[model samples]
Target: MNSLSRQLKQQFSILGAFVVSFWTIEILDIAIFSSYLDRFGIIPHNLIGLRGILFAPFLHGGIGHLIANTIPFLVLGWFVMLQETSDFFLVTLITMIVGGLGVWVFGAPGSVHIGASILIFGYLGFLLFRGFFQKNLPSIMLSVIVFFLYGGLIWGILPGLGPFISWQGHLFGFIGGILAARWLSSK
Candidate 1:
């Protein structure tokens, strides 16, 4: 294979790794929790525990919940890596860590949020804000397309979605992504 093809394959390999890792973790979390559902799920009233922050992101309520999160994660993650692999990983790691922590610190106790929606919003925010700084036509156009495509994300920020959904995590994750992008661009 040519050098360009090899590079593309390498990039895709990295993306695949990330998607598989997340899916694996999610599935394993479900399997583990299936046997001890009560012990694993975030118990909002007990917010002071470490589990409130770390375990919450891993546990999904059901298979449908897992599927709902996994698809967008793979698709949006592909796009983020395509734009810049390093940036994608950095932003994702920061967002997940910070967003998760944010939820622990401020979210209602026992609230568990599992999914990539928060990360998606973070990517969107980074892409849009970065476009403004770089003033790149391509980035700007892409940002516009992303904004329109996920325009309804604004509503996701609202608190009324459901008692089970951790909108707080989603909100903080998005914010973390935006902050990461700005910091990355500045450097």
Candidate 2:
């Protein structure tokens, strides 16, 4: 294979490994929660409790929900991680913590929404901004394409989309990602 193809393959392999690991953990969390559904609740009445952080990303309402989130998680994750593995992890970790905190802080009592979109949006925002600043043609093109494709995501971040989905969490995660990316780039 040519050099470019070889590099692409290697990068994809790395992304695949990351996705597999994330998927495995998610599945395990689902299995554990399914077996103990009575014990876990989506709402966070307590302040900054353990469940506030751990449970949101792990728990899904159903199989459809899980499937809906998986592709975006993998694709956006690959994009974000491809630039720099360390940045990928940092963005994801901060997104999750900040997103969850946003929900806990602003969400209605008994409100809960769980998915990877927030982190995905954050990563996308970071990539787009980075690409713009760096003046990298390919990255800039990719960001434009993604923005056009998933532009509707902005609406999902707003409240009143659904009773169950925590748009607040999504909004916070996205904002956190944008802020983080900007901060990272400035340094």
**Each model's TM-score, in the order given?**
0.80, 0.77
Minimum summed lDDT over a 10-residue window in model 2 is located at 35-44
Residue range 8-110, candidate 2, lDDT tens digits:
7766786677556556656665677553431242355555343646555655556566677778776776677666556777877777777777776777775
- Give the TM-score (vs. native) of candidate 1: 0.80
Q: Rate the local accuracy (lDDT) of all candidates.
A: 0.65, 0.66
Pairs of colliding residues, candidate 1: 43-110, 44-109, 44-110
Give stretches of model 2 more than 4 Å off: 1-45, 48-50, 132-136
Badly placed stretches (over 4 Å) of model 1 are 29-58
lDDT tens per residue, model 1, 1-187? 6967876787778767756765676666567645344244434445444463445444555667667766666655665665667777787777767776776677775455555566766676666566676677876786677677765775776688888777777777778877876787677
Find the number of clashing residue pairs for candidate 1. Answer: 3
Q: Provide backbone clash counts, one per model.
A: 3, 0
Please name the candidate that would achieve the greatest TM-score relative to the true structure: 1
